[model samples]
Target chain A: MAPLGDNTNIAEEVMVAEAEKRPVSTIVIIIAMQTEALPLVAKFQLTEDLDSVFPKGVPWVRYHGLYKDLHINIIWPGKDGVLGVDSVGTISASLVTYASIQALQPDLIINAGTAGGFKAKGASIGDVFLACNVAFHDRRIPIPVFDQYGICAKQTFPTPNLLKEVQLKVGKLSTGDSLDMSPHDEAAIIANDATVKDMEGAAVAYVADLLSVPAIFIKAVTDIVDGDKPTAEEFLQNLVAVTAALDQSVTQIVDFISGKSISEL
Target chain B: MAPLGDNTNIAEEVMVAEAEKRPVSTIVIIIAMQTEALPLVAKFQLTEDLDSVFPKGVPWVRYHGLYKDLHINIIWPGKDGVLGVDSVGTISASLVTYASIQALQPDLIINAGTAGGFKAKGASIGDVFLACNVAFHDRRIPIPVFDQYGICAKQTFPTPNLLKEVQLKVGKLSTGDSLDMSPHDEAAIIANDATVKDMEGAAVAYVADLLSVPAIFIKAVTDIVDGDKPTAEEFLQNLVAVTAALDQSVTQIVDFISGKSISEL
Candidate 1:
């Protein structure tokens, strides 16, 4: 009876210590549009908009909510089509991602979105890719010192061992700020061994890497880079499906992150 | 006397026809800060906001004015650090530049700003540089197909003959979307033979190239890359002088663009 009482005290102490330990509390999901982010927002049960938490009246639009013991923020860098061809893309994505990181100090950032895939590389519509690496395909720097414009230094390596738990393609993702990539550009991207092309992944990864934070790009193949089936029609047609797949990928990631300890991640 | 009358009539017709031709009516100058743009804005006497001209309540900020029969538009991407490190440098500049191009359909875009210089490459404080070509030094795209991030295709070759009219060093200007460059990065830049570095030049050039519009970058050396003094201190100390030089360069460019026909340029 006396030994049993002592054992109960030790068990209570351990339980209290575990309760005091904090898990990863903040998570930032960077998506270009409401549609892309909607599924994750819904899946995470994120309902609150912490707009009041930010300073009153700034053009920088931001949203926040709490999910499964984590704070979630969703921001649109700038509006779509307020600019032109490059409107859907912006350096503001990097800026916004950086700002969100600084403010929240997120443990991990998931840049979830859709991308144009290289059909020849076996990227099919509705297929989700977790970026093992990300590069800039359209950045043609003319200097002789470097061979390509892709910033391979910032290649976002996803936790492959952990990623195997999720069923998805893991490969190189190439990002460019513009969408009108020519066939020649497609050849360059393919030559680089990139399977996916996105507008904001590398930019997001670049900032996160600078800050020494881990970021993963979870993208769904919406259109093929050099596929012959009229890019505009294909992209528009597959937009919903890709976004749906993106939501599923983000959910899997969230579940993985939430279930594991930071040390494991 | 009758022959003389006929000659005079022909001269009048030719003058009217030339005026009707309207050489280069629109010029877009994309600058990051209001201070950098102030001199040109003042020099050109740009007094209109043109905010009303855009669809009301859009995030895209713009300034417009009619100067010597040329429409001048200047934009400030985002205020310095509402976002961290990559705040001021944005791909939004490209998007906005493209939008401005589409709206104004400018014949020429002059990306005027201050840059960190390469002293060994013969760059000094207050020295102006006209970008013969622009590349991205930070883009390490580990790929085999493309040669450089430098947009050699849109090489802004100074009318060497016309550039002699204005005294400024002309060379390749390298650009990246970040301010941080280590000694190793600096060495890479030097090896690439890039004499100057800035954030938005390559992006602006990329967009302009896509639209097939001619673009040029004229930058003033504000600080030496990897120089002895702290970059913030050096850049701040030289801000006034660099802006002054930038203003002078813009004046020279304005004079050239204004005086010569587009065909000559």
Candidate 2:
């Protein structure tokens, strides 16, 4: 150790190189449940639920780790305000995402999880889709002034260059707080040609858009929305598979971001 | 302070009385913009933007005041995370409301603002509507397993007894982040018999539902969604008048809540 820095030229070069490498300090990945987060948590070798460090939990619970010199945070805002029971619904998803953003102030936010694929749109179970645009199909405001209300008024899409860089399959996604599909609703959703449906994507995207924070939503198909089996059952049955796929997608995304220099982003 | 509580007996009596009286220690009122909050802020004499005191800024900017011994907070989460230009959308409203809840942990949350009334549903401009049950006409999750998704599954209504005590003209509100409406959408909304439409009510209600926090949504009719004029134009033209009405409604609501004892609630 005493002679380690004796090579002045090499030490200086090493320090300069280290300083030149742009690092991603914080990247927040939000998911609805611990199960959805487990894969990423394990893959990233996170040993702590950051929420535990704070006796009074913050709005979002973050699990921190380091991957390839980049800081990674897997966040889960349980169904309750901070922590309690696991809750479902768009509102919960949106609130937790908001809390995560406020608390972490991360450089990038990613919502990665499972969704019901629209088979007609060539979506199949296990396929991962990157959101080109996210719309809330359930926002039905019936008025004469604005048609955008019926659809999520603020449809969020990744910037073109990011898409070119990520080079993932792009698909429009429709999100709502529903586990089942009705004929009329299905028609409306299909009419928009969305490739997938999930409870949280649109809500997450909506928050990111409002904050002007760049977000990428990656969802793996869990089941078909209108398949013969009930969506709840199908979703439950395929959670492990879907989560695995989602974990992979997130890992790739993290690698890509970690590989990039600050200037490139 | 003249040794206000010098006497142990009197202090005990006063403390008991205070404990018995159901005081709303924190009442969080969320509105989309400053204009919507103007009436309440003026009425309550909140001269300081609580954010100013923190310097670093809280998740949601809080305006402080007192109404009949009840703490009042008027909050707005502007665009761009915590601060920036005010944004009008479902996402912003939901996130801000969530942040407000996290920051204030208020005993009660009220979403006060203007909304579009459905003339066919017996609504007219300038009228105040208290939310009995809030549903999202736009959350049309047309799936088989979970019909609630299409209808915001948790359609929160004040306990029947509370509604009776409040004695306000109660109506069901449909919320979405849109300023305009189309004919088809209008018909669908009308079919649902929603009396009013606004951007933030449903989102707030959705959050309140998750937290099991009691929330009241008070809105003044700013325009008729299917009225002769465009909703945008009508909303802008009538904002002052509508806000005035909304202000009055919030005042009344506060008075009602302040007047109630914990037992009454």
Candidate 3:
């Protein structure tokens, strides 16, 4: 296979050239998935969280990392709507992520994770997309439009422009904290819903924004809310394709930014 | 002053008592203080939306009456914290006052308002003490292994157990969403570095804990946090007496809940 790479060496050149113009900080890429990180790790021929798992501070598996100038990290934000619902996982993990990044005081942050897709038709498994905006998936204060938006104190930093760059092939995305596994039939009946659903995106944006770090949130679309209830294992198995796509995208994104000028990037 | 009467006579009692006795639904109260709806409005005054100001709607303000039980109405999950130092006045006028007994869900909630009290020998502001538990004001997290605990998800709720309710000399209190301009010290300190600091009590127990319909939160501390630099306006202000009292014991809490049984008084 020729691979998702563009032999034109076009993306890397485009980024490096741009870097010469505008200032670009060392970019960090994070991936969030519900399954094991081995396959993805093997593909890149990189050692995973081996250090953390081997000596074993925590017997249970978890994801956190400090890689190359890329600074990639990974985590499993829990699955099944009710079991691990709420923004806390995202907030807590993001806090750790932010603290780590803040130490370096990087200029930008990029988060990649898996999410549920709710399309009516070709909403197949393992598709990749980018989120434009994110909402608290679990928070639903359904006040009528006639009612005021009321007061909510929140901090959401700007989504990286790189997200906008992928809008063409990937398409737009929406996020909420709740994992809407209501099955396609039931979800279709709901009055309001989003195209993609995930938990961490907004929380990451919030903390990153608070610290003045621009952030990019991307996710692989894994499960479609179909009538037949799929197990978490099934969902993880389906994530393989999307995972490969994510790896390719992150490298390209980094190289692309590398090419840009400091001022213009 | 008159008694609060039995909760049963209060209507929310007749409607909620049965359900609350069981445990299907839970009520939670958060005092953001942005919309100053009368405390009683949640109980008796039924409106589509506060009539004029919110004739249209109030986002999170919920109104649910039991089937065929019209008098049984309660509103909330109101704003979490007061708007800001700016909107404190206009919004508080219509939404808050010390006159009404607003009926909010959650049988037990704490009014966590911001305050400017001194930890300094004579002028430190910013302390969180339980009204009743206020017997002793000084605290450090996990001290006495009981006080100053946080009630986030994955943790057990704080159960004060009506800690020996006493007599009522200064009972029958009301909540105000307005910020008290006292103890200029807080203006010099708070807000600059907290997720939130408002015109109510420690919002911790009120918002995070899962409770029945009898929750109530009251915060009587100062409401603004500038920096250690108090300006001319802050220096001449008389804040000691009131704040000192707010920092006093909660002995009256039990007496207040005395005559009022789970049913009617």
TM values, all candidates: 0.52, 0.70, 0.42
Clashes of each: 14, 25, 76
Q: Pick the candidate with the highest DockQ.
A: 2
Candidate 2: tens digits of C-alpha lDDT, residues B1-265: 0012222366654654564366667788888767777767889987656344321322345678777878888876543332233455566677666566665677778888889998878888899888776766555434343345445523454545455665456788887554666454465466656888887887787666544456778888999986798877788789997898788768866777786653355
User: Candidate 3: where are CA atoms >4 Å away?
Assistant: A1-23, A30-90, A93-102, A142-168, A181-193, A226-234, A259-265, B1-162, B165-265
lDDT of each: 0.64, 0.67, 0.36
Model 3 CA lDDT for position A198: 59
In model 1 chain B, which range of ten residues has the least summed lDDT? B78-87
Better of 1 and 2 by DockQ: 2
Interface Cα RMSD per model, in Å?
Answer: 19.8, 14.2, 21.9
CAPRI grade, predicted model 1 = incorrect
* Model 2 TM-score, 2 decimals: 0.70
In candidate 2, what are the lDDT values of residues A1-265, reduced to their tens digit?
0011222476654653553355556788888767888878889997666435321323346688777777787777643432233445566577666666666776677888888888878888888889777776655444432235346534454445445665456788887665556554576577667888887887777666544455778888888875687777788789897888788878877877776643344
